[model samples]
Target: MNPVAIRDSYDVAIIGAGPAGLAAATLCAKGGLSTVLFDEQASVGGQIFRAIEETPVTDKRVLGASYWRGMDLTRAFRSSGAQYVPEATVWSLTPEREIGVSLHGGSVLTAARRVVICTGALERPFPIPGWTLPGVMSAGAAQILLKSAGLLPAGRTVLAGCGPLLWLIAWQYLNAGAQLSAILDTTPAGNRARALPHLLPFLFSGYFRDGMKLLRAVKREAPVIADITSLRAIGDDRVTHVEYRRGNGAAQRLAVDNLFLHQGVAPNVNLPMAVGIKHRWSDEQLCWVPVLDAYGNASIDGIAIAGDGAGIAGAEAAEWRGRLAAMAAARALGRSVPDPEETHVRDELARCLRGRPFLDALYRPARIFRQPSGDTVVCRCEETTASQIIDAIALGCPGPNQMKVFLRCGMGPCQGRLCGLTVTELIAEHRGLSPQEVGYYRLRPPVKPITVGELAALPKTDAALYAVTRM
Candidate 1:
């Protein structure tokens, strides 16, 4: 099959149809650029703005007015004239900016153009004893299961972790008819005390209303505990109990059938890293965000990153960033637009992002001192022990990538999505590089696995043509 014959190029290809990607696509399309938005899920909203086929019983109470705004964004994307392809998994992104998307019918789409990656984020998992148990799941995953599938884990489940997500998921479970055993938050109360000054602006603006709603939900459902020290799920096939230490160093155990854990989120940088975009370690966010200008132009000439994928801002910031990126891309393509409107949008987003007190406080993983137990595997693939990693550090491995070569820490089915950040931190602590300097390891394409038939069908010569053409 000739790749060119099957491929359709667009002026802009947005890889993710979430709040950010959808916003980018809508803005670009409305600006008169032929745009296409691709996503792996069978819907436009990304994880945060999840699509619900059935109106959730908890929608009115749980999501409130803010969620309706997200739905409006989705509707805008649908009507913006941009091609929205759901269930399209983008397997590889070449540095040259040719996007390889696998569609539903085994048909492949090679979209060539300026690409915007709004690939959101995954929840960071804490490696603890019995975490691999069946009933143990990320708080985000539990929320998705409840909101999207109308299902929750069996029996009473403890929602444990730090950050706003903990409260958010607890509310979801409570509304889903699942018993909330407790809300065990690991964030120190003093952290909130210190953040009060920064949070004042949001408070005055009524942005704190969201936090109040979450707190109200927590108060209504279960007891909320702060400064939890440790969590250990206990059971063979499923979680039966969770043992945790309080701030005073007293150990307590809660017997529950399920546990929801969330440390935080890391930028979903696998594909962006694979494409060789310049990344900077953000101390504030404690993650690698693609380095981009105010307009969202990344290090790559025609590639851009917006929203949480660039850094961990919520849906509002993402929407603004997406619009800014689309505007920049349009300007780069020699299109005209109102300069003052773009400037105002950028300034307002910057202010909103800066005003969020929780952004920095919640960006890093909950516990820095907590290391995976020796018996608990560090690298799931080779089953490397945490002790082994410590030993390698003592012998002076350069970084986690080197440790990966020795122990196969990152060469797993999930492709280091589960353990990469932890390994990098461990390596940085050992080698004396700042966590920022330690850096995320490089990713190579095809980022996700692909079949041989798809590879065989690639046009032999069009690689060069696709490389040169910018839709």
Candidate 2:
């Protein structure tokens, strides 16, 4: 095998350029390891720290101080001589730690090394009638459109969801010259009271200060309605009106041109599952998170998961986990990790775990999954109806993987990010099994599509090595 023909190998391949990946790459490079950071986006700073080009950082308040911290971190990574590959989507991961990545101009590059998956989470879709309409989109999608692309939905938009992201979207939409009809937050106010005792100690003045800033931003622009029971988007071609059942059981309808809905996020674990990593259910977050230790080591050696890919801890927590994971990987590779620094990292991680009350209280999954409307679209890929999934379950489809074969729910361009959670719930309900038992459908490489020419161009020796590892 010609050495030049083989793709590059790194001491550490960080699979996402988001907060976690960026943090890990920065630390690993600084720690004297050859690091390469890969991201599907054109720039670093995953979803939480979305990248904006040439925009003056004048509106510091809107961007928040944490956002600026992430910016500084990216700068440090760039200066540390880490290879940053943007607009590169990693399609799959082999058990031997080789990553299949689709790059610009349809070229595929393989990076083989100790792997860290920081491939964050996707928004949980709340499917209702007219959800697939033109103007209806996930809350995170709306934020991305506004922040990344500087575009808004067609007209007046109603933001509906249960997370802090809803408030952020409302603030962004209002600032972007888009009219806001209302903000329907489904999170119950009582949740705060219930979780208050656990959160009180962590309620430093800074927490309240940030909350007040967000509250002041959206207070006058939109009405914040709490305890929303149900939502229905009604329109023939685009969103025209939104009907919601209030906490008081009174049905209310608002005339709106667009509707943005979200129900928090779940780990984008397809790549990890494809690599056969273990996972477990998170009852508090209501999703399946990859099984990782305190240092983000998965069951598989040389494979570490950090950030929302391990679980949906926010940016700060992700950064800590990323650093910890990198240190653990370094130690596994026969490098010495400073004992004092490792202890400090573990303590910081503990603090982050302690500060997660607001996130958990604000982002619980909606109870609406208990009774999915028969007509609502459960699988957006093949346009599989909820009824079809129900019937498939009735016909003895065992789980999501089998259901995908039967009904093609998760087999699409978006790869079930839009509909996987709902399908899992429906299958679990029908089979009388827990949602965790249904599990996410297994993901295969190429996680994303690759041209045949790219595959054929792979060095025969490398391909043979990959084949041997598979056996």
**In model 1, what is the error at residue 135, expressed in angstroms?**
0.4
> What tens digits encode model 1's per-residue C-alpha lDDT throughout 225-283?
77787778888778889989887687888898878888777789888988899988776
lDDT of 2 by residue, 1-471 (tens): 222232468888989888889888888877777778888998778888777433343366555575667777778777877788888778878888877776764554566568999998888778877789888888898777655666767666788877767777776666656777778888865777766766664565244557667778798877788788788888887778899987769788888877888877888877888889998877787778887777888988889999988887677788888888888777776675454397788777776666576668655756673247678887776898888888888899999889888988889877777777778878887788888888887777777777788777655676687887864
Q: Model 2 reaches what TM-score against the true structure?
A: 0.90
Q: What is each predicted model's overall lDDT from 0 to 1?
A: 0.76, 0.77
Which regions of candidate 2 are displaced past 4 Å? 1-7, 52-58, 152-154, 175-178, 201-208, 248-250, 336-340, 369-371, 462-471
Error of 2 at 33 (Å): 0.9
Candidate 1 clashing pairs, residues 3+ apart or interchain: none
Alpha carbon deviation, residue 147, candidate 1 (Å): 1.9
